[model samples]
Target: MDAFLFQVLAGLATGGIYASLALALVMIYQATHLVNFAQGEMAMFTTYIAWSLINAGMPYWPAFLLTVGFAFVLGVLIERIIIRPVEDAPVLAVVVVFIALLVILNSTAGWIYTYTIKSFPSPFPKEPLFGIRYMSAHEIGAICVTLVVLSLLYAFFRFTPLGLAMRAAAQNAQSSRLVGIRVGWMLALGWGLAAAVGAVAGMMVAPIVYLDPNMMGGILLYAFAAALLGGIDSPMGAVIGGFAVGVLENVLGAFVIGNELKLTVALVLIIGVLLVRPSGIFGKVHVTRV
Candidate 1:
C-alpha cells in the first residue's frame, strides 16, 4: 500500500510538469487555432538563458523571472516578424515556418551550449514536504505552484478585461475588430503569454530531468496528448488531462509495462481516447447551421 501510495504521489508531481506545458499549448490553441510545433524548442532556449544567469551568480528566482520576461519578448517578436506575415497563409506554410523555427532554435542551442545537460537547482528544500516521506519537498512545492498558476489563470480569464479581449479576438477576429479590439495584437499577446508559461514549465521540470537542449521534446509530446485529451479548447480540461496522463504513465510504467515503454503507453492512450471520442472527453462538438 505504501509503495502504491508513493507512486500516486510521484505521479501528481510529474503531472504538474505536464499540466504547465499543456496549459501553454492550450493558451496558444485558444488564440490561434494552431499549434506551435516549436513551443518546446522555444522553452529550451529560454531555459538556457536562465541557466546562464544562474551560472553568472544570479539567484534562482530572479533568473527565472528574467527568463520568463525574455521569453515573452521573444515570443512577441516571432509572432510579429514571422507568424503575422503568414497569418492568412495556408496551414502548410505556417507548419513549415514552425518547423524551420524549431530547427533554428535547436541548432543555435547546440552551437552555443553544446548537447551537454546541466543540473538545475530547485527552490524547495531537498527534504520531504511537511516532514512526510511519501513525496519530496520539491515535488510537492512544484505541484502547489502549478495549481496556483492554474487558479490564477482561471481568474485572469474570467475576471480580467484583457483576458476577455483575448478570448474575443480568438473566437471571432472580425467581430472583435468591429468592437474595437486589436485582434492581431491580441494574438501576439497570446503568443507572448504562452511563451512565458512554457518557460515556467521548462524551469520547473529542469530540476528533475536536468537541463538539456532537447529536454522538452518528449515532454512536448506528452503535453500534446494531455491537451488533446482534456479538450484543447478548454484550459480547465487541459490541466485535468495533464494530471490524468501523468498518473496513468506512472502507474502503468510500474505495474504493466516497463518504464521504457511509457511513451508508447501515452500514444496508445491518446489513440484510444480519440477513437472513442473524437472531440475528446471534455471537448464539445460544434455544429454550424448553414
Candidate 2:
C-alpha cells in the first residue's frame, strides 16, 4: 500500500500541473467561445522567457513574476492585433489562425532557443516536504501553488467588479455593451489571464519535464483531456477533471499499458469522451431553436 500511496500523491502533484493548463483552456473558451490551439505553444514561449531571465542572473521568483507579466501582455496584444480582426469570422478561419499562431510560436522558439533541452531549476528543495515519505517537496509545493491560484481566481470572479464585468461580457457581450462595459477589452483581459495561468503551469512542470520548445505538447494533450472530461465550460469541472486525468494517467501508465503508451492513454480518453459523451462529465448540452 505504501507504493500505491506514493503514486497517488505523485499523480496529484502532476495533476495540479495539468489542471493549471486546463484552467487556462477553459478561461479562453469561456470568454470567446473558441479554443485557443496555440495555448500550449504560448505557454512554452513564456516559459522560455522565464528560462532566459533566470539564465541572465535574475532570481527565480523575480523571473517567474516577470515572465507571467510578459505573458499577460503578449496575450492581450495577440487578442487585439490577431484575434480581434476575425472576431466575427467563421469558425474555420479562427481555427486556422490559432493553428498559425501555434506554428509561429513553435518555430520562433526553436529559432531563438535552438531546440535545445535545458535544465530548469526547481524552487522547492530536493527533500521530502514536512518529513513526509509519500511526496517530494516540489510535488507538495506544486499542489499548494495550484490550489492558491485556483482560490485567487475564484475570489476574483466572485468578488471583484472587473471580474464581474468580465464574466458578464463573456456571458452576453451585447448586453454587456448595453450596460456600458467594454466587451472587447474584457475579452482581451480574459486572454491575458489565461496566458498568465498557462505560464504558471509551464514553470511548475518545467523542472520535471525539462525546458524545450516542444515540452508542453504532450502536457497540452493531457490538459485537453482533463478539460473535456471535466466539461470545457465549467472552471470547477476543469479542475476536477485535471486531477482525475492526472491520477488516471499515472495509475494506468504505471500498471496497465506502461509509460511508453501514456500519451496513447490521453488520446484514448479524448476519443472515448467525444464518442461517448461530447458534453463531458460536467458540461451542459445547449439547444437552439431552428
Candidate 3:
C-alpha cells in the first residue's frame, strides 16, 4: 500500500506535465479543426529562451513569465504569417505545413542549443511537502499549479467576453464573421494562448526530465494520448485524461510492462481508444444532414 501510494503521487506529478500540454492541444483544437504538430517544438523553443534568460542572471519566475509572453507573440506571428495563408486550404495541406513547422523549429533549436542536455532548477524547494512521505514539494507544487491553470482557463472560457467571442468564432466562422466577430484574430488568440500554456508545461517538466532541444518529443506523445483519451476538444477531459494516462502509465509500467515499454503503453491506449470510441471518452458526436 505504501509503494502504491508513492507511485500514485509520482504519477500525479508527472501527469501535471501532460495535463498542461493537453490543455494547450485542446485550446488550439477548439479554435482550429487542425492540430498543430509543431506545438511541442514551439514549447521547446520558448524553454530554451527561458534557459538563456536564467543563464544571463534573470530570476527564474521572471524568466518564466517572459518566456511565456515571448511564446504567445511567436504563436500569433506564426498564425498570421504561416498558418493564415493555409487556413482555407485542405486539412492535409495545413497538416503538412504544421509538419514543416515542426521540422524547422526542431532543427533550429538543435542548431542554437547544440543538442546538449542541461539541468533545470525547480522554483520549489527540494523538500517533502508538509512532511508528506509520498510526495516531494516539487511534485505537490507542480500538481497544484496545473490545477490552478486549468481552473483559470475554465473561468476564462466560461465567463469572459473575449472567451465568448473565441467560442463563437470556433463554432461557426462564417456566422461569427457575419455577426462582425474577427474570426482570424480569435484564431490567432487561441494559438497565442495555447503557446503560452505549452511554455508553462515545458518549464514545469524540464526540471524532472532535464532540458534539451528534443526533451518534449516523448512527452508530446503522452500528451497526445491524454488529449485523445479524454476527448480532443474538451479541456476538462484533457486534464482528466492526463491524470488517467499518468497513473495508468505508472502502474502498468512498474507492474506489467516495465519502464522500457512505457511508450508502447501510450501507443496501445491511443489505438484502443480510437478503435473502441473514436469520439473519445467525453467527445460529442455530431450528425450532419445530407
Candidate 4:
C-alpha cells in the first residue's frame, strides 16, 4: 500500500509537468488551429538558459523568471520572423515550417550547450517535508507550482481585458477584427504565453529527468497524447488529461508492463483515443459547412 501510494504521488508530480506542456500545446492549437512541433525544443532551449543563469551564480527563482521572460520574447520573435510569412500558406507548408523550427532549435541547443546531460537543481529541499515518506519535497513543490500557474491563468483569462481580447480573437478572428481587436497581435501574444508555459514545464521536470537537448522528446510525446486525450481545443481538458496520463503511465509501468514499455503505453493510448473518439473526452467535434 505504501509503495502504491508513493507511485501515485510521483505520478501526480509527473502529471503536473505534462499538464503544463499540454496547456501550451492547447493554447497554440486554440488560437491558430495548428500544433507547434517545436514547442518542446523551445522549452528545452529556455531551460538551458535557466541552467546557464544558475551556473552563473544567480538564484533559482530569479533565473527561472528571467528564462520565462526570454522564452516569451523568443516566441514572439519566431512568430514575427518565421511564422508570419507562412500564416496563409497551405497546411503542408505550415507543418514543414514547424518541423524545420524543431530541428533548428534542437541542433542549436546541442551546438551551444553540447549533448552532455547536466543535473538540475531543485528549489525544494531534498528531504521529505513533515517527515512524510510517501512524497518528496520536490514533488510537493512542483505540484504546488503547477496549481499556482493554473490559477493565475484562470484569473487572467477570466478577469483581465487583455486576456479576454486574446480569447475573443482565438474564437473568431474575423469577428474580433471587425470589432477592432488586433487579431494578429493577439495570436502572437498567445504564442508567447504558450512558450512561457512550456518553459515552466521544462524547468519543473528537469531535476528528475536531467538536463539534455533531447530530454523533452519523450515528454513532448506524452504531452501530445495528453492534449489529444483532454481535447486539443480545451485548456482545462488538457490539464486533466495530462494528470490522467501521468497516473496511468506510472501505475501501469510499476505493476503491469514494466518501465521498459512506458513509451509504448503512451503510443497505444494515443492511437486508441484517436480510433475510438477522435475529438477526445472533452473535445468538441467540428462540422464544416459547405
Off by over 4 Å in 1: 288-290
C-alpha RMSD of each candidate structure in angstroms: 1.4, 0.9, 1.1, 0.9
> Which residue ranges in model 3 land beyond 4 Å of their true spot?
288-290
Candidate 4, number of clashes: 0
lDDT ranking, best first: 4, 2, 3, 1
- Global lDDT of each candidate: 0.88, 0.93, 0.89, 0.94
Candidate 4's TM-score reads 0.98
What are the TM-scores, per candidate, against the unseen true structure? 0.96, 0.98, 0.97, 0.98
Off by over 4 Å in 2: none
- When 2 and 3 are scored with TM-score, the better candidate is 2
The residue-by-residue lDDT of candidate 1 on 195-229, one tens digit each, is 98888888888899998888888888888888888
Error of 4 at 271 (Å): 1.2
> How do all the candidates rank in terms of TM-score, highest first?
4, 2, 3, 1
> Candidate 3 — which pairs collide?
none
- Displacement of the residue 288 alpha carbon in candidate 2, Å: 2.6
Over 1-290, each residue of candidate 4 has an lDDT whose tens digit, in order, gives: 88788788899999999999999999999999999999999999999999999999999999999999999999888988899999999999999999999999999999999999999999999899999888889998999999998899889999999999999999999999999999999999999999999999999999999999999989999999999999889999999999999988999999899999999989998999898888889999988899
Tell how far residue 261 is off in model 2, in angstroms. Answer: 1.2
